[model samples]
Each structure stands twice: as structure tokens, then as C-alpha cells.
Target chain A: MGWTGRILAGAKFLAPLAVLLVLWPILIRAFNVNPQIFPDITAVARAGLESIRDGSLFAHMGASLARVAVGTVLAILVAVPLGVLMGVSPGVSAFLTPLLRFFSVLAGIAWIPIATLWFGYGFGAITFVIFNAVFFIVAYNTLLGVSTIPMQVRNAAASLGAGRWTMLAEVLLPGALPNIVTGVRTGLGFAWRGLIAAEIIATNIGLGYMIFVARDFYRTEVIVFGMIVIGALWLLIDRLLLAPVERATIERWGMVRSA
Target chain B: MKSLAIRNLSKTYFDAYAGAHVDAVRDVSLEVPEGEFVSIVGPSGCGKTTILNMVAGFIAPSSGEILVGDHAVAGPGPDRGVVFQSFALFPWKTVLENVAFGPKMRGVGKPERERIAREFLSLAGLSHAAERYPNELSGGMQQRVGVARALANEPDVLLMDEPFASVDAQTRMTLQEELTRIWQERRSTVLFITHDVPEAVFLANRVVVLSKGRVLEEVDIPLPRPRRWDALVESDDFKALANQVLQLVRSA
Candidate 1:
């Protein structure tokens, strides 16, 4: 679609959120809710402005985004090649499938407890949790993706003089890209939740910690503002980033099934 | 172009359903000389594909040697390019990229490989669709790319296994005619496999009929070059050659 068309679609998507924003303060005023219990829109906006002015919002956001970027990047780097190896060899896949399933089942926030014990609090522990959340899902999906490539296609590549590395780069990687992107989307979802949980328990600076700390002061505006930032950030990442990657790979390739 | 020689080729595999070993191909030997088109026709269970698979080095024979020129074939390589029944074009790659894959593998520069790709695509009558992906094309168009991909490699031998089997009859005929036209222009040594009798007879210089995993008969086709479905479909010579091969296939 053209730039204008995309902008129109983006505006349409955000309209519902805009309506909710408009309704939030109206309903809070109508109900006459106490500020201690729930913050009104203006109070939340004021809290957001205060945080921004103090640079605390940017600090927290930067910390969280860095941890997420490092953890997810490391997880993907290790996962995809391991997954492709497992996919290429049935013996390897069979042996690892059970272990992979077990870890995948135990992924995300569940790892936070031990991760804290192993790495202690703060960046290392929280990063480990985020990594746990992304690694298993992406690896499993990569395996699925690689294995799903048709045998005839492999043969064709081979006969056309594709060597080991060439086959992996030209044939296997592109073939598995759609599923890999899907895995990334789902894995990132889990990573975000795990990050928030880990941050609340471990880190002093982040959206989760900001919200958790506000509870002690009965600063419901700060808590609500932090929550809004968290949700909005996730929405932006999903819509602006992951959705376009999926469109480029899956939808463009016509690999998206009804299922 | 290099000649392909299959010596005492055989394949035996365990059949789990039957709980026994099944001899898929047995003691089959064939030769396609340089610049000649040879088609192997057979029934479904007669192991025509198995033999092709062996020659293409996708699978090893039970006991035999496959030679392309003086080089012994042990595994799939650029020397023996294959066009599968499924068309087997890389779904993610554009038609140009798919056709350019071989030269890219051979370490040709981007500009030269793309030039080769465009040349082959034009030869296949698909230059207009160069930037399109395989899924965007019809089955016939896909097979055309498949053929172009193999041909662009300039392999010593071009292996085709029922390359037009999935398309409609009309498209298949058109593909056959196009193939003959391309082969006439650039005579790469070819090994075509199919269950279709007329396809075997129409496309090959000689038709090798197979039954029960062995050579049933090898019928020579002295039919004129530049053969087309429109002119040859009803001609006595084409019918006689097709009928002769069909009877041999049915007799088994």
C-alpha cells in the first residue's frame, strides 16, 4: 500500500484506543473514584509529564529496552542454528524433542526464581528470564520451520550445486523464515511479560519497578502511567515491527494458512 | 554436453507394510549420449523415478555406477541438474533468483549470473515474470522456471522427472513443445522420466520403456525435429511411435 493508505490504516487501528482514552477520565469523574484507589486521566498525564521532566521515564524505558534487546538477540542467535541442526537430523530432533518440550513448558516467569538464585538480582537475572521466555519457543519454531521444507526442494537445491553452507543460507534459512518470524512474535510476547515480572522482583529501574514502587506511596497516577507506557510500547512493537515482518515474509509468500 | 552412463543399476529397500525387502529397480542399464534426449517411460511401481533418482545422485544405487562423462556420480551436483515433477522452485526466491541459483553456487558474480538468469528466462518465455515468486505463477509457469533453472546451469546432463505431470493436458502439451524447441536450440544431454506414453515418445530421441524395474524395450524415434503437438498430434508417425511405446508399457 501507499504511504497515505498505511497512515489511514494506522489511524483506524488507533481509533479504539483513542476512544478509551477519552472515556477513562469521564468515567473516573462520574464515579467520583478516590485518587488513592484509581487515578483520573489528567492525574495520570501529569504523572507522566513529571516522570519525563525528571528523566526517570527515559531511564526506565532505556534499561528495559536494552535488557530486552540483548536477551532476545542472544536467544535468537543461539536458538536458530541449534534448531536447524535438530531439524536436519531426525536422530537429533527425536532426542531433543522431549527436552525442548519440557523447557518450553517451563519457559518465561517460571525461570525467574532459579535465574535470580543463579545470577543474583538485577540485569543478569532479569536478562536470563527474558532469554528463557524467548529461547525455547523460537528454537522449537525454527525446528518446525526447517523440517517443513519439502524434500523435493532440498533435492533441487542439491542438484543445482548447493553445498552445506549454501543450502543452509539460500534454501533452509529462507524456507524457515516465515515460521521463524512467527516464533519471534510469540516469543517476544512471552519475553515482555517475563521481563516485567523479573523487573518487578529484581531491578530498581524499569516500568515494572516503577509501578510496583508507586503502590507503597498510594501514587495510583504513577502506577497507571507506567502501565500505559508498558501496554503502549508493546502495541507499538507488535503493530509497527512484528506485523510488518510477518507481512513481508508470510503474507507476501502466501504461506499463511487459515489455521 | 556429457553423456550419462548407468551401469547395472539396482535399488532394494525394506517395505514395512509388506514386512519384506522390495526390489524397486533391478539391473537396469541405460545410456544417453551427448546432445541426445532420452525418456524413460514406465508404470507407477515400475521404478522409473527410482532410476532417475539414482542417476541424479539423490539416492545411491544398490549396486551400480553412474557416470557423467569421465566423472563418477556419487551425490547431487551441478553436473546433473534436475527438474522435479513438483517444479521444486525455491518458493521464497524470485524467478530470476531461482534461475540464477546455480551460477551463484558456482561463484559467478551477481551481474553475470543475473544475465544468465534473464537469458534462460527469456528462452523459457518467462522474462516478464522474472521478479515474481514461484507461488504467484501457474503450475505451467512454475515448471517453465524449473526447466529454465536447470538449463541456466548448463549442466552436463539435465534430469527431468515428470516435469509437466501436474499441469493441465493443454499446458503439458505446450510445455512439451516448448521443451523440444529449447532442446533443439541448446542440446543439453537429457534424461526425461514419465509415466505418460505420448510425452515420452514426443520429447525424446529414443524412448526406454521400463517394467518391473528392468528395461522392457528401447524404441528409436526417428521423428523429425521441431516437433509440435498441433502438427504431430494427429500425424501417423507420432501416433505409431506413441502407440508402439504405449503397447509395450501396457503389455507389462
Candidate 2:
């Protein structure tokens, strides 16, 4: 709760990773594993440093992050309002629920082949995959969130003289925010994974591409380094960005047990 | 201040699947005079909440009309404020912001709204928690905020649907006393719904008892003003009034 307490808690999270790092080298020596199968810890570290020195690591990470950002932002901008619109009407929401569910299930990796065909295997195709991954889930979740607001709250707002616009702004939006933020977090997760898969299949740049290309040349060290970079990047994004946003929304809007 | 008049009001629900008609409230008529505190007490299925909701314009009567002042109630509007049993405070908003919501909806300026919110929050004894979100507060505190939010709208009539029913007994008592204090100062016409006989007797000038979707009795409370819960509950007059209503409900 305090600054020092938070710092200590953050350090506690690293304990498992620290143990894994320590075990990694010992396991490498004990097994006498072929380098082709798995690179040594030092080899992976050197590969990481080499990529960083050449600036390719930053370029790949930037490309991956940028695509996710652009695609997710665009998806959210379109999905949230549309979701709210559809959700406000029970008839519309009921009619569209099954359709949204179907599309959400078919999102992300399933769209990669069609997206590549449509956009000709480049940034456009990869961005499309990420967009597809984020869009349906966010929209469906937004619909769920908006529809779940208790009628009593809306009535309370209306009785207090909230007009259509006022109710939407003050009651509907704020009430549904906890759900919307959750949708964004989930959508981003799917989109992040989709972005990696799309990059591997279609794009010439990004963390996925870096690792996939390494596999062909027997560059297991580079592949391992890329995997670490991907994992670290995801952890940072989830912990620093999405998780905090989700936690704050839930804390602010959640039905907390009374103390 | 304007009185609330319910004229031959009725609500019937058609259960399509069951192929049956349910009369939630039947030919209910009552008058809550301006600045009067009226409580509707009833058994579980007596539709006390239906009457409250109708007055609040959340539900339309199948027949007859509800009038606040000279205006026939059309729909829910700022002229009437409702306090729900669940508190219904916006979880995302801070205490001050929740209180300010009504005034803000009515296009009050930001500074004026804040001042109005502060005044009501202080009246509710929640000024100390102005910045705290609804979820952070105790049930009583959140209900206090709910009271402030309703009052902040400056409605002609205050409609409360069992507002204190959800809280613990101790908190409910405190809230009842606090509500009486606030009502004494503001002199707003109030229609409070509750199942608890003692609560009805404690808060209302007149306690209306309902049974089977109909008015069973409306007993007047002659208890003196500035009533304290501890002292009032033990008094012979309070007990008599509560017992009378309790008997009506139990018999029905």
C-alpha cells in the first residue's frame, strides 16, 4: 500500500524468475544438451546483447508494439460505441449476441490466412489480424457490460433528470466502464498473441519474425533471445499498462464487500 | 412544496408463459401532503415498491394517474428523487461527485454543483469522505451518500424504496435518525417504503399499511419532533403505532 511496500511486493515477483535464471545454466551443463536443441544461457545473453548493439532488437520490438497499438486503438474506437449502441436496445443485443460470439471465437489466428490473402502479406495483413483479434472480443464484452447495468441505477439517474445524453454520459458509460476496461485487457491479450503469429507468418519484421527466421539458420541462441524479449515485453505491457488499468477500474467501480 | 396524489392507480402484470395476470397494486390511492413524511409498510408481496416506483415514474400505472403538484407524472424526471434500498450510488464516482450528479445533469455550473454537493454531503455527514468512491464506504455511509444524491436534485418529492433495509440493524438505526434530521432541516415531502413496522413508525408522520396489493390502513403518528431512535423506540406511543401496523400486516 505504501511506496516501500509496493517496491517489496514487486521484488517478490522476481524471485521465481531469479530461480529459473539460476537453474538455466546448471541444467545446460548437467544435460550436455546439443546447442541446436537449446542454446546455453551465455549464448542467449550474447545474442541478446549483439541484437541490441546492432539496433535490430529495438526495431523489431518497436514494429510489434506499434502494430498492436494502432490496431487495438482502431478496434476500440469502432467497437465500443457500436457495442454501446447495440447493447442499449435489448432486441438488437439479443439478435446480435450469437453472431458476436461466433465472430469472437473465429478471431485472431483463424483470420491470418484470409487476412494475408486480402492484404498481400505485409504490415496491412498483420495489422488486420491484430484488428480482427481485438475487435470482436472488445465489442462483445462492451455489449455485455452495458447490458448488465442494473435497471435501478438507470432509473435512479433518470428520476434525477438525466436526459438521454446525460444518462449515457453519467450513468451508462461510467457504469459500463469496468466491463469496457476488462474487454480491452482481454482483447489486447488476444491481439498480442495474434500479432506475434501474424508477424511470423506474414511480416518480415517484429519479434515473431526474428525468432521464426532464426529457426531456419539453426540460430537457437537468437531464437531463445527473441523468446525472452517477447515474454518480457508482454509482462511489461500487462503489468504496467493493462493490469493496472483493469485493477483501478475494478477497485473504483466494483461491488466491494463492505468493511 | 407540492403534494403527491395517487388517483385510483393500479398495475397489472401479464405473465405470458404462465398465462396468468398478476395485480401488483390494485386501485391504490393516497395523498402525501407537502413536507409530510409518509411511509408505506407492507408484507413481502403487497407491492409497496410498485407504488413507490409508480410515484417515481419508473413504472406506469395500468389505470388512473399520479400527480406531483399539478403535473400528471409522465416519466421519471428531476422533480422526484428516489433512494433505493441498495443505495445505488455510482460505484465509480467519489462521494462528492455522486452527490453532484443530479445538479450536473440539470446543467448546473461546475463550481455551483460542487458547492451544492458539499452542502448536501455535510448534511448527510459524509463531507469527510468527499473524495472516497462508493465502494470504499460502509453500507451506512453509502446510503448516506445516496440520500445526499437524491436531495442534491432539489426535487419536489423524495421517493425512497426501503432505503435502509439492506444495512445492519445498528447502521439502519443511525441512518433513520440521520434521515429524520435531514428531513427536518430540508422539509421535503417524502414517501418511504419499508417492511419493518418500527422503521415506518419511527420515520413517518403517517404510516400506510398495505396487504395483498391494497391499502389496509393508514395510521397517523403523533410522536413529537426531533425524535431520538433510542428514546422513541421505547416510548408507548411508538410501540402502539408500530404494533398497530404490525398487526395489520400479520393479519393480512
Identify the runs in model 2 with alpha carbons over 4 angstroms from their true place.
A3-7, A23-34, A256-259
Candidate 1 deviant stretches above 4 angstroms: A1-8, A257-259
lDDT of 2 by residue, B63-181 (tens): 98999998999999999999998887788788899999999998899999999999999999888999998878888899999999999999999999999988999999989999999
Q: What would you estimate as the lDDT of candidate 1? A: 0.92
Q: In terms of DockQ, which candidate is strongest?
A: 1
Label model 2 with its docking quality class.
medium
Worst 10 residues of 2 chain A by lDDT: A250-259
The alpha-carbon RMSD over the true interface for every model, in angstroms, is 0.8, 0.9
Model 2, A137-243: lDDT tens per residue?
88898899889888888898898888988888887787778788888888888888888888999989999999999999999999999988888888899999998
Candidate 1 chain B lDDT trough over 10 residues, lowest sum:
B225-234
Residue B26 in model 1: lDDT: 92
Model 2 residue A96 distance off true place after TM-score fit, in angstroms = 2.4
Clashes of each: 0, 0
For lDDT, the strongest prediction is 1
